[model samples]
Target: MTIAGAQIVHEKLEAAVKLLEVHNVDTWLILTREGYDPSLPFVIDIETQDTTAILINKSGSHQAIVSKEDYETFKQTEVFSDVITYDTYMDEVFLKVFHILNPKKLALNISLYDHLYDGLSLGLYHWLERLIGSNKLREIEVTSEPILKQLRCVKSKAEIEVVKKAISHTTDIFEEVFGKMEIGMTEKEIGQLFVDRMKMRGVTNGLGKPYDLPLVCIVRCGLAHRNPGDHIVVPGDIVIIDFSLRCKGYVSDIARTCYFLKEGEFEPPEDVQKAFDAVVDAITQSIEALRPGKKGYEVDAVGRACIEAHGYPTIKHSVGHQVGRATHDGGTILGPRKTPPRPQVEGLIQSGEIYAIEPTIIQDCGLPCILVEENVLVTDEGPEVLSKRQLDLITTPYKGVK
Candidate 1:
């Protein structure tokens, strides 16, 4: 049987067709070198070491033109309908496709506003201009931002299942790592434990910001604890483990908070519990208010309001952001209600989009940061929480002194 990703890729291609037609784009070009393009994961399945050009049109046409060395690898993905290989003369092959299709409104993966659609490099831009000449280059629309962003925001069933698998591993790792935590263990040790556990499970990287720098994912664990250091986890300290893993091309962003107990303590301190409750309430409010046609800022207001209602200061970052392919999958951001004029923040929330609703409280009742992040899918009915919500602060029973 073909794996679920095959079906998901097919769905994505179909969606791309509709999006092209809606936007009146004749051709959408994604040109990248060394897999720097963010949309590559959504469109092309395999990794490419050399330059690649994926051309998509409204008529259900998908073609991938890549270096001869990478041709077989790209074809193996089976996502594209046509795969063309080129050796020394890449510009010739690219121009041939350009002349054949002769798209009036060619859309390239270049955007000044959102990084999600701005994967085109300066060198690639110059190469493309030289390939097509200046006059024909005028037809280039640079309108792939909304089209590509929309395609990624909506999660197909197959895509959702992949993310769920990642989440399962993440939650399981949390249990195992937290179980071994002792009072004398330094924060760095805890972070390293999570990293080692992920590597043991064959997970290579974790996403701090979705499209994170190469090795930064391993140490982006400060969401629960401060920057990993030699500081020993004290009895009163509440540690938050905010981490994500990339599994099978799909990424999982998850976080859980635990309290270090004093001797004979059965549960978390009252103040911490209250703050945790407030964070939960904020997430609940945001999830309840999420639906198709709702604006990003509006949904953010629901969570921000709830946090402030509990006498906590307003959150510094966005209430939530879409997650898929990258950690901070840009496009629709659940930001402040009184948002400044920004493209994604002011955009409408559509059904089929996946959002990470994470409301954070800084220095809450003497705690450094109290935060809870949950993944949710926007459905026609309402928001569907993907990751299991952290209802109560995980209580770490006192392990005796070292």
Candidate 2:
């Protein structure tokens, strides 16, 4: 790891230690083989070939046991107090360390609600049970979901910096592509502009393959999150680009809507403009409600009400989700409250968390859908809009055919 990367890992390690103390977790254990655990990258940037155990104690002691081949890799980091290397099996060494730590509450990566914390595979869980014996495993085992939630949801200073850079790069590409867009360009061609820009900057799509990175919808026949096709943009066509890019292991997700004005027209049709206005209002209201100490559903309701009040159908998806290491970083979800409120929606919004607020407005008639997503940082005062807000619909004038 470079100096900066190593510094980030150290910062995360320090934060993880504090989270363990806050949650009353005596010891936290992560078991991985062939890079299975999602939390591995955040904690340590190394991938292990064989079964590896990462142990962090509330007492500020950290240790790791890896295969002989991977010993030097872990040791070189100088983060772990003790890096033990074994020849054949790690069960014996892991048990030895378990006995030494003798933690009263041992937290493991297991959760039903959050996939990011559900990194411990069934096979690995069984292996741990067998190795430590079922009775003792049950006596000390606890889910690491609470600690993982804060660890992932709350961003460090370095993490925020990386995400900011990612968002800046993503928005810049959007501006460049939208500025050069024309009436005759196919959805695929427009999507290519983003790809070209990403390549030039040495960045990548946040979620999937580059070709499938941005969802380029012509808005009439296209669906959300679907790949761009050969559908050509014509006069009066509304285009929605949902794009995200990965930077330095972090991600940024933003969406923009554009209109191809017909000849002599300066603005989009009445229906499109109305839908866009409603979307902007929803986003604005949602951000106002995105403050610390608020529940996810509370913030979501603000945006949902704004859209419905404007005579639009209820949004299909949640108003927003926490964005971080992943696109949907798997923490609090700004969604509607249910009979028994879902754990994710009931999660309280805290400072230091970044959210992508995207509320969709599908028009009543044949008008195209309006989706405006913005990234924000929750603070004590309110949310600070990280991305440039799309207050008005972007317009590309139609140049008559040659």
Clashes of each: 2, 0
Question: Which lDDT tens digits does candidate 1 get at residues 110-207?
Answer: 88787878889989988888777877787565568888888888887788888888877877877898688878777768777778777788774555
Q: Estimate each model's TM-score.
A: 0.90, 0.97
lDDT of 1: 0.79
Off by over 4 Å in 1: 79-81, 208-226, 364-368
Per-residue alpha-carbon lDDT of candidate 2 for residues 312-381, written as tens digits (9 for 90 to 100)? 8899899999898999998889999999769899989999999999999865445668888999999888
Please list the C-alpha lDDT of all candidates, in the order they appear.
0.79, 0.89
**Total clashes for model 2:** 0
Return the top candidate by TM-score: 2
The residue-level lDDT of candidate 2 at 52 comes to: 90
